[model samples]
Target chain A: MPSRQRLWPIHVILAVGAAAMVAPFLWQLITSLQTTGETTSVPPHFLPSWQWSNYSQVFHDTKFAQQFLNSVSQTVIRVLAQVLFCSMAAYAFARLRFPGRNALFMLMLAVLMVPSQVYLLPQYQLVQNMGLLNTLAGVVLPGLFSAFGTFMLRQFFMSLPNEVEEAARLDGAGTFRIFWSVMLPLAKPGLISMGVLTVLWSWNDLLWPLVVVNDDSKMPLTVGLSTLQGEHLTEYPLLMAGSLLASLPMILVFLAAQRRITEGIALTGTK
Target chain B: MFRKALVLAGVGALALAATGCSSSKSASSGQADSGPVTLTYGIWDAKQKPAMQEIADAFHTAHPNITIDIQLTPNADYWTKLQTAAASGTAPDVFWMNTPRVGLYAGQHQLLSLSDKPGFDNSPFPKALNDSYTLDGKQYGMPKDFDTVGLWFNKKLFDAAGVKYPTAGWTWQDVISAAQKLNDPSKGVWGIASPDWTQENLFNTMLQAGGQAITPDHKKSGFDDPKSLAGLQYALDFITKYHVSPTAQQMTDTQPDQLFASGKVAMFADGDYDMPEYKAAAGLDADVAPLPAGPDGKKATVINGLANVIYAKTKHPQAAWEFVQYLGSKEANEIQAKTGTVIPAYNGLSATWVASTPQYHLQSFIDQLDVAVPYPVSKNTAAWTTPMQTTLDQIWGGKVDLTTGAKQIAAQMNAELAKE
Candidate 1:
């Protein structure tokens, strides 16, 4: 009976947490369906006629599809680049013995402590000098390398058993060969987890894209949604519809990788 | 090792290819050898884009050698981007600037002086409008249009409630009495939209009450003065004491404009810029009247205008200045006025503007301009709004008494003024 009581408390806590997380999304869904008149009613109606045409209107009114494509391409490129570069750098710092590697790794980690806003102006200037302003490269290049990714992967790599690598080294394999053939395949969960995070961050980013891309045609989903919002200020249903579309891609990515992410977390804990 | 190197090389090659594709794409869009010089014109309002394009087309007919490119940044992001572009020396050749921001940009030497530009005949624009763009006796921008705040009321609501529509001669007490009689809470109808934090609308109210929003030299806050305090007290009492307007929390939840547009409120205070939106949303005819007089029997309103200026860093200053001058011409202002986008600053174009919107008494806006006071502003205006808004919020929220809130706002505004 005491065990049952303890289980009841756990269920109650989880139920509350789940409700808290879901309440906002449900509100957004309901708000997205409300007409302009119903949206600002004095009592604030919670449910109104489902204006499903709002989704169609958002697509028809703005360059929503093109912006969605831009966001997808930028996010895919950033995720792949971060995963490859961070893992390679993490392997070097964790396992390889090279001159000045420790100091260099520390310097890289120190960059993580500096706020990203501090580098905004200089980074923008650098992109301008390189003639990459108003281009997707400007958005993708600055975020390709992340110190947080390196540190996380480095710790994961370090916590791995040394016997497998030694055995691979004895089998006529060099540093790159072992890292690529034996270690990389085993680090799939970490890479997938990092890729999901990179995609999520890149997809929702606003300020940098707004600064770099001046043309509406070149803007990503986030900036495009903002412009759409400004143009259709009186149309709340359409704005909410566009917001729902923008969030769909990230939601799909999260669900698809949820299993791998949980497994990666469990593995890290065991280490 | 070779395989790893190949992968790294592949990634690097992909990045380089992507960069090349983007650069080549932009290059192909605008042919480099085209003899007609391409000039970029920046504006803040997308709603005004059609009128600007019309002006651009007309300018192109006269100066066939020049091509104008329209670039729009919204109002909130315009100044920040303009400052950055100015710092980088890549600002558009011609850009829309406002009175509040022109002083700072001009002081920094970032705007091309238009005082000597040909075709800039100031005789066509009102003196008050032209003076807004002039600083230290030198003009940096040319007046394009002017606007003022007024009471926009729903004629249908007034007819339904059996309340007579507000006239230009009404006083503040008249507005309150009518609001109290017309309010029907059970029917989701309110009498007014008492804006909580905006100083532009409230400044006119204060001035009508024989008060000032700031000192003459723009050094101190006038909110602590009895007249200013009384003005704010009257505004706050509409929501707190009389319950004619929505509470602060209700206004914060959804903007007052939304309430008015949805017909939940009978009246709202907004500028001419919102005229198109209200007409489109409300279905019924919405009319404008001069702001009511205060207890001091004075009627005041706030007047402001937008201007067209040339960037100092432009590669083609002469061509850009020509475009800017043309935008301020009667021809361009007529197009803007006809479109109901703004009230043209050109003296005779206001009648055409009034004719474009026949649903409302749009001429009342121009009539009120004679008594309109310019928005109280200084070089450090941005520094003053933050704290001033916060203290005013307390007054609107009924957390602090009107006198205390006024005193606190004055102290904060004075500190900000000292920093300048």
Candidate 2:
């Protein structure tokens, strides 16, 4: 067994780090239960009076259920698309013998260099021209492809043993068949990490949704919760309650995938 | 590192917002269209949203064929979205228009001219407010609600200091003396808090001194004028020279409203928009009085109001105009007033608003309306205001002489105004 004395310093450091991350969330939780008068008070209140009604108010007042569904739908569509399309593109860049392979791979990498914002307008225009504005499809389409996912998956596919693909080819299997059946199973960690990340990102996206979707009924949780903030006076209690409600699904997602997330980190050594 | 990534993302979003704007301009406006239209009415204030919803429901009750869908973008993102939408010629059919931006929007021909619309009236609201939306002698929107600056004070703090509450005719000298008597630093109490905000603090003082924010013709800034500089000095002295007010650093750490609510500050300059929040503050008794007269012996406060404007490119102009007419009508104003959400622009309804919340004498806001000067705006106010605000930040921080900062800001503003 490890000695308690030897673990003390490490324990203290981890505790401090954990508390630093958790304190803001705890404050949010406590603030969510306080009265607007109590929350906005000077010498800010630490203890919650446990007003259960703030949560109720969020449901009754705002379109919380509709927005929550929008967030879930958008995230689910984005994650599935990223895992499927990114893997297909990554496989082409990794093992397929196509002409101009180097040039195409280089072009894909160059896209990673350009900021994501450069595509916002053009993508928006494409969506607009397609007459998808203020629709669920508009929120999902731009998020369908991701450069980072392609790059990460391509590297992971490349890192896999070459012998497996050659053996599949020797068995008279086609390239697409080899990627789908043989190589994809080995690249699970990379796909899982990319999927996890895409879920987190698409769930929290605010600006793009606000730009394209003007209707509140169609907005995701991120954009919907923003309207809780007032012009001169923000009611912090209501804001916290709305945010807490919106973020609960994300928290559940992280918790359920906790072991896989850690495994992904171990294999990839990166987020 | 995370902050850098977020900044990069923000920059990307701004680029997207810009491109998103021009790409959609092809969705052009048409001549008066009608029938079963769903009018999207955008507003910024969530506090006033419920009242707006009530107004929308009432409009739907009358105009059975048209449906009013209320869209809310929080105040910060409201303008960015509006600007991009306006640029793309897809702005909401009718939206809340603020004073500073309406002029710019109107000048670009993005807003419909309300004067020509049938059954539209601007006569019920204050003329100063109506004139705020009028550009080149044509009204583009009908005024909704008006706000004027007043001195918000903590009665308990004044009582503890044995100082009398501020009265209607209080001058700058009276405020200064009272603040001096109320200051107690050892107790962590300040006589007053003077934040470097335009609407809440400095803008009213500038007007009280008979100064303007910009030239009437929108060609030049007034910061270089002697009267305007003096007005700015009066506001700055509360922090730089006097011991009565909290230092700039302290006010930055804590908002002036919080300072007052906490009992650390005895007084602050704010508008009636803050009334609900003040009423909600625990252990606080707050009331407002007219902004003190300036050294020039005239009391003027900035009178800015919200207006409802129709999108220039709207396919359903008739429905949008009908909604705007309903918004300006007395019934809607009364609903807005009864909520105590704002001082309704309609003259008689303001008394109902004053009576809506009687705990604090909100009548001070109404009394100041008589001497209310329109908040200064040029054809492109944001163009000049952005540069002036950046320069004024240094002056407010006491990093440069007020005069030098004023002149520098004036030069930048003049250069920008010349572009328009």
Candidate 3:
């Protein structure tokens, strides 16, 4: 091990890096408690005036509790659906000897290349036709499957040893049983990382919800927070308060899953 | 094998479902007038949403069977959502429309014509506003509100500098002399905040200089014209030659509006739309005056307005029209004026808006109406405006000379106009 004196430079560098990462959140916290006048002052106000009413003002203006529930439920559904569907499809591509498997995999990979905006209109129309606009089902349906999730898991599944699967088959286990009882347990890290990605994406989704959901009651937190913004003028203090309040749950979640997230990311080999 | 079959069946089922959706959509557009109607009204401003809701409630009182649902999308996503919704034939029954997009939406037949409707009168609004939504001799939008550029000054800053407040008929020379006096570098204060903005700054200057941004026919660019170049130079000289205004980089760091509100900028050219914010800002003593005249003693301001327009494929056209008509009525305009959210486009309502915020001379924006130029726009204004702004940024940054930049912009703008 290196001596403490020898490692001082690395520690200093890391401290600076950590501070840089944390500065924006600290600024956001300060701004959330400031008045509109204080927020826009030149040279900026490092110390807040502590106008806590800004948080109350956000709640008064928007349906905060309802949007919080909407965001949570939608994020949960999207994460589960992506994990369940992507894992199964990933397994099939990794293990099954299906016809035109290469072509199918290539086609799925092509989806990852195209931007999500390209699918927005067609997806919106499809949901509209299904009479699912402004409903939880409409928001979750498009997010249920993702090519990136499938591809990421497929790579993980392929890297697993074939001997373990052969051993399971020798005991007369079917493909479904082997995938559920044997392979799934081994692919836990891949599934966790994919689910984490899905959670982040669904939680932050603004455009699709803004398009599909017209009612304030049906909006997710992201869309509801956006309503606080105006065409020409926006109350930054109120917006920051709402954003800070909205991000609390996610921050707690990240703290709880910090170790698992890092471990999963490392095991999966790609973010 | 079973999973593969399930996937194939799923794909086939989705295709069949899509075809089924298309068939149902055709029947939706021809909805009956007898049923209870709910017209979705789309708007982007959160500050104005409450006033809009009040207007909607008043409409609902008159037409008990018709309900108005207001949809609020932030301005950033409003156009994107509108474009997508329009493409799918599921746009809002009525929505707010601006001058730049009126041409495209009307030309594409995505908007319903309000002129042909019975009892529809265009005389209640200014001609410049009416002409903004009229294309090819047909009116598609009912003017809701209008905004014009004005010289907003900080009274305290003017007094501190011993400069008299700018009044009506003040010329450009007066502005330059006052700015030179007011500028205080030690206090980190600029005489003015001059940003490279079109509606609020450049277009008004261009018109005041007896120059047009585009030809009357809207088939060519006027940016390369000598008069237009002079106008461009006039705005540029504030930063480079006069050095009384904040640099482009400084304005970017702290937006011009914020700088003005914080007393760091003595004067700013902005639209009346920003009055509500200025009223709410604490410790800022501000007032408005008409913009100074150009070299030849011509006073001009660029005027733009928002309109209430009905989507062409609305399920209940009659109900939508009734709501739209109510929105354009004197009562609705009064409500708008009382809220001070906007200067109502309805004739003679400027006094009502001015009284709503009595501290400032809101009438300055209204007084320029006589000389106000219609906001110059083409079928696809963004095609040229977007590029023109990019080059103007370079010019404002002192990377390009005004004459060369103006000619470059004119050439690009002409090409876009030709395409249109």
Residue B416 of candidate 2: its Cα lDDT? 77
**Cα misplacement distance, residue B380 of candidate 2 (Å):** 1.9
For candidate 2, lDDT tens digit of each residue in B1-420? 111122232332344234433322214343455567799999988899999999999999998888998889988677656665565556789999887777666766778888877666778989889888999889998889999889999999899989999998899889888888898888888888876677777777777787867776778888888888888888888788787787777777777778787778898998888888788888898788988998868998888888999887787877788788899999999999999989999988888999999998888999987898788777666666666665666787878889999889888888877877
Candidate 2 clashing pairs?
A: none
Candidate 1, what DockQ? 0.17
Q: Give the local distance difference test score of model 2.
A: 0.82
lDDT of 1 by residue, B1-420 (tens): 111122232232222233331111111211233467889888766567778889899999998999988776654455545554565566788888776567666756677777866556777877767776777777888888888888888887889888999998899988998888779999988999897645335787788888888875667878888998778878888898899999999988877877887787887877777776676562545788878988978888777788888877677777777777788787888888888878998888899999998888888788887787766766556556656766677878888877888888888788877976
The share of true interface contacts that also appear in candidate 1 amounts to 0.12
- Of the two candidates 1 and 3, the one with more favorable lDDT, higher being better, is 3
TM-score of each: 0.86, 0.93, 0.95
lDDT of 1 at B280: 56
Estimate, for each residue in B256-303, the C-alpha lDDT of model 3 and write its tens digit: 888898889998999998886787777899999999999999999988
Q: Give the TM-score, chain B only, in order for the candidates.
A: 0.88, 0.92, 0.92
| Model 3 segments more than 4 A misplaced | A267-270, B1-32
Residue range A1-271, candidate 1, lDDT tens digits? 5688679988999999999998987877887887765665555677768988888888886689899999999998988899999999999999999999989998998998897745655677788889998899988999898887788788878878899999998898989999999898888778887777677788998878876777778889887776643322346677688898899877887788888666655654521
Candidates sorted on DockQ, descending: 2, 3, 1
